[model samples]
Target: TAKASAPEGEDRGLSIVEVAKARMRDSVVENRGQPQTTRVTNDEEEDDAEDEDSGQDHGPLNEAELSRMAAMLSASALVVASAGGRRLRKLHVDLNRILDGKGNSGVFLQYVLSRLHGIERKSNTRLNPEADLSVLEPYEEALNLALIVAEWHDIVPQLQEQQDPYVLVSYLFNLAAEIGHANRVLRVKDMVSNVAEARWFLFWAAKRVLEQGLELLGLQSVEHM
Candidate 1:
């Protein structure tokens, strides 16, 4: 186990494991008492978006914003985990590639969020968190989409065991590409009828999975990238 020296001026000794356990306990308690906000109403969503946009205006970084940016940068560095192996190899660290908004992380977030916004805007209502995906049974593409969800579940344990962020990141990037293709083929936006509920739930599932994977990588899911 890792170890750490006690803080200066402390009378008692402490280890890193103890410090970590204490922090985890504190976090659990703090979060346990907070109510979860799962659904956002239309008005509330617009207000929240406006607030976020206002915060994004040109300005000096506040402590919290700086901290989040630090976290994002730190998180992005984990992409190096993708290059792990026994063989000696030189891996170029390309800031441009890593930070590309059109690349893996950015594309995944943008496509999923855009589809979500489209659904809410066209439907004139927020999605039910408990929305039924079973309605997606008939369509072959939906089955393929469901397979993605199942694939995510299967891969998660392997990711945890292997500690390979590349596998997860690549999975998300490819999933985003596949969904983009499926969306074009379905013409979800141009349908003569209202947006299909089943497809909405499918996209919702996709978004949730992507967000979960992103969170695992210590990444932020931005409203606008």
Candidate 2:
């Protein structure tokens, strides 16, 4: 959720994440209050048509929806926790790349959704909560993933104490990337019998970890990009 104070005077004692979220939320609110005309170009028209075909509404977004979008935009833009007063000549905020299912945000959601879809297609049933991951014990990548998650918890406290969002975000990016690589090598979806079930549980565990990380950043994972 993108949290914002009620038009506060000073931003004292606010964490960097809070400040960013508040600014984005305020921007959305100000823009919504303005009187404006919208131009629908050819590409936009096509996009609207596609959305309509998919049973999506073309109506204006509600407050909650707007807040979520603002949150994601803020989270996506905060690449560095602290720059030591450094400045960039040009900073680009690519809304398309951020929202269109690309980059770290997209990769995180994509891995989660893809795993769910793959599991469903293979089993046609829910993942077995008690499925044994023993089949994955011998895999070096699997063990490495377990270690990454364990390490994440250990560093979280120190990272929070330092007020560094960059490290947390980077951790998620690496976690997602490693899972993707492991899936390619393990071919979890192509396994048979207990191996498939076990790997499904492993993937589910990773998905849950990703979801927890996204929640910490106040970003919601999407079912679709």
C-alpha positional error of residue 152 in candidate 1 after TM-score superposition, expressed in Å: 1.3
Which residue pairs does candidate 2 place in steric collision? Answer: none
Residue-wise lDDT of candidate 1 within 143-182, one digit each (tens)? 7767887799777988888776556777777676666555
Best by TM-score: 1
Say which candidate scores most in lDDT.
2
TM-score, structure 2 vs. true: 0.52
Cα RMSD of predicted structure 2: 10.7
Question: Worst 10-residue stretch by lDDT in candidate 1?
Answer: 51-60
lDDT of 2 by residue, 88-184 (tens): 3233433333333345654335434445444434443347877777888889888877777677776679667876565676777777777766666
